[model samples]
Target: MTTSNFHGAVGTKAKPVTSQFQFGPWTLTAVKSHILESEGIARQRFEGELELPQVPEMIFADNVLRLQHVAGFGLEFNALDALKLVDAHNDPLKVAVAQAWKEARADCEHINEVVKPFDWTFTTEYKGTLIGKDGVQLKVEPTDERIDLEKLKVREKIHFYEDILLFDDELSDNGSSIMNVKIRVMPTSFFILLRQFMRVDNVVVRVLDTRLYHEAEKDFILREHSYKESKVQDIQGPPHIVTDPNQVAQLLPIKRETFEKLIFPSSSISQKEADAIR
Candidate 1:
């Protein structure tokens, strides 16, 4: 049987998290492992895309109104894990052959096919725990309690995408030699950022990029954009930024215990009665 026929051999295939990963201030704890799936049978036919989950609107609205900070948890990109893919596919022997083919203008597309196993994708569900700055640990349950808690339906979803394509030639033993790599955080990651501004102290998203050409000083560049509290003096954009990633990780609905203790704003009265009282 060809490799294309069976991608069913299932188990987590990832490298250990490197020390370089800095998740800013929030502490994350995960239960389940990240799952990797190949996009195609071979490198030539390979096409990959990140999967996005559908979250309900009520999840965002319900908690924001309560003035409580919602923490983001679950699976996010592991830049370090991608190196595993680069290392496997970009073997020196394979790179040499790919180079030879291009130099000779030869047509051997199997190179792409043989390297297909190295092109992989991962999905992380919102099932984990996050500790806020105040030391409150919210245990995120997988039951997806938005509907029952917020009276909100998840009719649509936010999306963020980063496509990493590693040709057989660009791959390397450590995945550092891989080039022409495009790293991006989709527009959908900014929802949790509101928490950073309104209540939390730190928030950030991670990105990884590999090179496509020789003479690149580094194998990969790890970068991240963090949110900071700033006051905007002009309208050119937001006080801190002009645009933002789409939001994710809505605050959990307020519980009965916390709801009863909130200090509500003063009730409104019509202006006519106020004028007479004055």
Candidate 2:
């Protein structure tokens, strides 16, 4: 068994969050606990992807600790209750779960196998487009406007064509260093067009969020395009950026509740109009 771990400064807490861990029959789940300990503290987001083998047995357990003065951290964990999986090839009690684990493992193995052949390279020809909130199309002159490709060369960044790949060290199998790739895209006019053909809005949302477009850009779209319609309401004001400087580097999704309530309620236009613009 192989394992991979990648760490990013996710708002200061040492806890991991939203990592596509390299190897595991199971993954650390979302933290159900959100206790605040300090006045200037921020919450941590913890999540993981799991891969379990066929006919396996496993158990999960945890231990909690209390901190004392000087903010001394106390730790507790049930190592005996560590990730475990039992083979249930014949047991009637484990048929469904066993089969599910088998399927999940198979999927992960396939992805690892397929992705291994890829050599990380900068994408210059993979032309991307951007669509605006209103329906206007923005001309994407890659040669002139491709300013971001250089910033990606910095430390802790690896661009995999359309997204950045992050590997987990603890869960890697067969020395496979990659766990998953995350894409960063602003929901511009061209993106909307691509979304139609690629179905990027659904599956892609897990890896990238398209709602990061600027209000000025969105307003430019509304002014240039004539069609306006939406199931939800339009946005009245600009997007409220997350102010915490620590979280700026971390990828996060647009708050769905906030999106529906504030932004989508006002600016979204009709699908028919969207089609006409295309």
Candidate 3:
């Protein structure tokens, strides 16, 4: 489809993609495929260098494809670098340079394999029954209200590598209105290891609480705006002031002021005015 048609159709689906460099094979592949589809996406994917979980859906889709390369981190030890390091080590001033280069290369290789997946599965350990206040066992009828997650304290144990998410339901013996559900989550440790390639560790857990996660994010953004405003006040005092040329220069980083009254007052001294004052 054309760019306008594609953008209109995709909506938020065409939003930017960020990378942590540590993506599993499937995740990387999906991300790369998304990038290949559009020049804007490709540019964003490479240029953003954003961490994981920042855009949860993008990470999820990309995690399905599995990419194999780090975006900007070029090899520090190509043949040329190797030769230069070897020559430098030959000098009396840099005898350890060669060994240092080898260590650095090894470390980079280790980082490269971080996003690869391994056995990422866990089993649901708890055995229990769900019921309503009416003394009806949930095993008989799976009604949303009877065993609904809203009232139920259901916990889930997720294992990423094994590709299985285990759902656990734990409740109190009492016939209380609320079902005490406990979600015991465990994903393959290797999945975390894969994130290490991108210097990340909490990838799977990061995506677990989507709703609360966004709420917290919104709160953070608001707080950040307040903090920024406070800082601006501290640095610049009250905003309304004479539109002196110097003050206008200081406010350049902010958007240009449309109204002369809203902006700083002019302080430019014309040649005739300066001569008259002198």
TM-score of each: 0.18, 0.17, 0.14
RMSD of each: 23.1, 22.1, 29.3
Q: Local distance difference test, per candidate?
A: 0.21, 0.21, 0.20
TM-score attained by model 2: 0.17
What is the clash count for each candidate, in the order shown? Answer: 19, 46, 33
Q: Could you tell me how far off, in angstroms, the CA of residue 272 lies in candidate 1 after the best superposition?
A: 43
Per-residue lDDT tens digits for candidate 1, residues 1-278, read 00111123345543222111112211222112222233324311222221111111111110000011223222232222222233233222333333443344233343333533322212111111222343433332222111121211223232321232221111111111211122212221111111111211122221121111101111111222222222123223332331232221111221111011111112322224333443
Q: Candidate 3 — which residues are off by over 4 angstroms?
A: 1-48, 51-278
Weakest ten-residue segment in model 1 by summed lDDT: 57-66
lDDT of 1 at 68: 19
Question: Candidate 1: which stretches are off by over 4 Å?
Answer: 1-25, 29-46, 50-70, 73-76, 79-98, 101-278
* Higher-lDDT candidate of 1 and 3: 1
Candidate 2, residues 1-278, lDDT tens digits: the string is 12334455558644432222111111111111222332232211111122212111111111111111111111112211111111112232222332333344565544345322211110011112222333423332212112232433344422111222121211112111111212322222211111100011111111112221112123211111011111111322222212221232133333331121012223334344444543
